[model samples]
Target: MSTLVKEDLFENLLESAPANFTEARQTAKDLYLKLGLPAPKEEEYKFTGITKKLEKSLSNFNQAKPLSVEENLIKESVFQGFEGDVLVFSNGKFLQEVSSTIEGLEVSDILSSSAEIGSIAKAEKDAFAALNQASFSGGISIKVPKKTKVEKPILLLSFNGANDGQVITPRFWIEVGDFSEVTFLDQSISMGEEAYFVNKVVEIKGGLNSHINYYRLQNESNQAIEVSNIETDIQSDARFTSVNISLSGDMVRNNLSLNLLGSNSEGNMYGIYLLNGKTHVDNHTNVDHTIPHAESNEMYKGIFDAQSRGVFNGKIFVRQDAQKTNAFQQNNNVLLSDDAIVNTKPQLEIWADDVKCSHGCTVGQLDEEALFYLQARGIGKVQAKGLLLYAFAGEVMEKIEEESFKNHVVGLIQDRLGSKF
Candidate 1:
């Protein structure tokens, strides 16, 4: 299947959009065309074929249409049953009634923003990120005040609407002030049985000495397709921790990039992907160390069962001027069946002489030694396997500083493994 060129996809929308928006959209289209969908020749995308996966139709979603979801969705989608400010978007349009929780955070509709939003939208280079800015229907903008710390985590839910056979794009921008701290929980869900697509981009900016903990949980139906981008910029002495949990979708693609622009900055990234049946999940991450004395650590693990396929591609780049940089990245996977497949690549490109960078990847099945130890204690084979799987996955979950949140993730993974065992 061949994908449509940007010009062909945007001809009608360009003719109808406002002058400034149309110009921005046209410029974005030109950029995407010039950098056409990245092929294997691209260094960062060499192992992951993103363009081939996006060969499906790029239909424009209806901006004016609002999707109505059942009340139960709100109950099931809540994170650990604790919520502060909740912003919900169904079928890419903001639903205000079901998303009001607390006043600790300020939320605004992205489409209603004034010229300031457009100005910020012009500087992005990601293909999907730029496309979202050019034609996003509606999203939420979250702002945390200076020196303030949110007591509860903010929940951002993106659900597929009742649109029979259409695609949706949801875009969001988040800003954290100096000395502020916040936690955001994002989930993608489906409302009806109809097939849909979600193309989302989330851009975050953390100020000096601030902290931001973000969790992305994708749990859409098997027929749904999702492509997500989470990009962050951390300033001096700031801390950014991102945990991505992928447990749903027919075809899933994730691009997570973190840029350390200040000295003494720290970034911790961890991901756990559980795939089964015929599902395919691909996670690509890039860490850019542009300043001196920055530290970043990444660990991503995948468990593939049945005939599922998993892919992990991680790249860490240390600039020539970035001295005293310490970065470590690793990817590990477990295949439960002989037919299951995993493709992993851990890459490092360093130009600085004083930087410490290391990368390695492992692709195989469960550890026989550990399984045997469990079985020797009178545990059944199914129970023994589940325990070993939990042990292998606990390393990534330990990075979550919040006790309650960490326990919540542990529960989710345990439940999934229990059903299979």
Candidate 2:
């Protein structure tokens, strides 16, 4: 990581960054210099080896060039029957011509706005987040005013173009005001045939008594690599729900952090990852209970086939001041192939005596008894496997509040499994 950063590739990236974020970029660069990259020896990253992949990707990386996209290409990526505002980005740059008009939301350019850009995504914590702050060229700052309730969900579409071996950074900042309610959908896809790297960071502030539901879907090209961070701060009585679905990528890593800053706040994190071929996916989440009476729950499930690999690490921290905190976490995985592998770890750190916290993880294959029972009932072996896998993954999918989105995910899972079975 140090050698890659010292190369001319990083210098070129810095030169192309927007002028308005010069100070922020320099700050991030300095932080990266100090922190470098995490190694496998680190407890948090022991199960995932990302340093080599990141170094190789950054060594040959060039800045993304402007892509000329067709209307049909964008239309093909949009969800059918979605009647909400859509924000599109090509090669990590915002495309206004294809974006829809959004009401009751204030969206501004992050580079030109006076908003505090890196307030929640501090460079001192995560090096990938710092790199995103240093290299991002275009991003948005969205604010939902107090007492406003959005009737439709907001969609953010990010598409990578045909340039091979380029590095792209996407950043976003969102603030949900007091008593507001909104749903946000974030989707990432690729139009390129060659392998590229995407580094993204998102910072969100949930105001007092606000309700925010966030959905993230990643279905990029099999040759693409991605590293993303989502940092959120929840205020008093606010409710924050995050659902993440990862279906395709060569190598994918997600870092999610939630700070329960106020009492009575609630946070829920749910995820499903389906991996095949030689793909690798890693999900790391941390929830900080800083105030008393806050509650948090997390559940993540995965299915790995062929020679694919998956990793899940969830940590919950109950501080001394958080006396009555209630935290629970669970991670479960199923391996369909002999060569497939999964590493799951659920951790709890409690400093208060009055808290109820528990965590558990499991990594195993499908139940043979269930398969035998299904086969006795006239089900084929392959069909039985698919049925069991569907039921295992459906536990997390059923938690999705949006019916349309949940059905869409079910269709994708069916399509992916239908070929294998």
Candidate 3:
């Protein structure tokens, strides 16, 4: 693999694009220069050796004809009863033929919506997010009308390339107007025929008093590699909640960042990950309280088995003037095998004296006492383990208020456990 840097890709992308988008691309390119890839000495990325693991040759790629992915694959990957618009991306290309458009929603391509949204993706503190903006070729742009509330959930489906060493990059931008409410479910799945790499970037803008519920499902084959970034700006009194589920991947890394730019805004982040058979998953998140009277809560849980590895790193920053802020973060993990590994860190950087902020993390195995007690009650060992494991993961699962979606995730977890136990 050639030792290609982000600057090479950034320059090539800018040279190929039109002059109209130069300003936005230049901003991202400059940010990439300011903040290079994280080194091993960096505190936040100490445990995650992403730069070392993902050192592969960059392929000059672009949008292509959407793959002939099966409709059954789409039906099996999303939340049940979700009857809203569907945007499908196969092999990093927009599949408009298979996508659905909602009645009141404006779904357009990223380039098409630039005039109205004024360049949806920005380059600020995140290097990978900036890299995504610089190299992203195609994505979906969704806009909801002001004061409108959608009854159904919009689903975005993405599938990886079906050939070996094929890398697919898909990006998304979702915006909800003032006083609007909507639910978005984005799922990434890989076809089982070959090994592939999937890179995705998703940006969300929540208007004043708007409510947005987002769920991300990352379940691909063991040979797949995934890197996804999601950044959101919350307006005054806006409510945003995201639940991220990571089940299978060869190497999966997620970057979730939220900017509380307006007061009285609320943000909730919840994640659950299950891995086995040498799978590796990482979740890195940042929640910034830039304005006063903002509240944020984050929790992530994981279970690893049979030499699998999981990593969780979360940071909550309370700015100096952001008083009256309430932030809480916790990460917990369970190791089901002697070889299974989990590394978790919850960090809090507070400059405001009046803020209430706390962070904690724990890593351990299944409760031996609970297992023995269940066994004494004539319960099979495998069944008892599944029950205990379910209860361990149930903490974050309870945050899903929608019963149907919650139950569906629970069922998926059970199915995963049934295979091993």
Stretches off by above 4 angstroms in model 2 are 1-9, 57-59, 162-165, 419-421
Query: Candidate 2 — worst ten consecutive residues by lDDT sum?
Result: 1-10
Clashes of 3: 0
lDDT of 3 by residue, 231-330 (tens): 8889999999999988887788888988898999999999999889988888999998999999999999999999898889899999999999999999
Alpha-carbon shift of residue 123 in model 3 (angstroms): 2.6
Candidate 1 lDDT, 137-172, residue by residue in tens: 667777788998888777787777446435577778
Better of 1 and 3 by lDDT: 3
lDDT of 2 by residue, 119-156 (tens): 88787788788777877887678899999998888888
For residue 267, model 3's alpha carbon misses the true position, in angstroms, by: 0.5
TM-score of each: 0.89, 0.95, 0.89
Q: For candidate 3, what is the lDDT?
A: 0.77
Clashing residue pairs in all predictions, respectively, total 0, 0, 0
Error of 3 at 333 (Å): 1.2
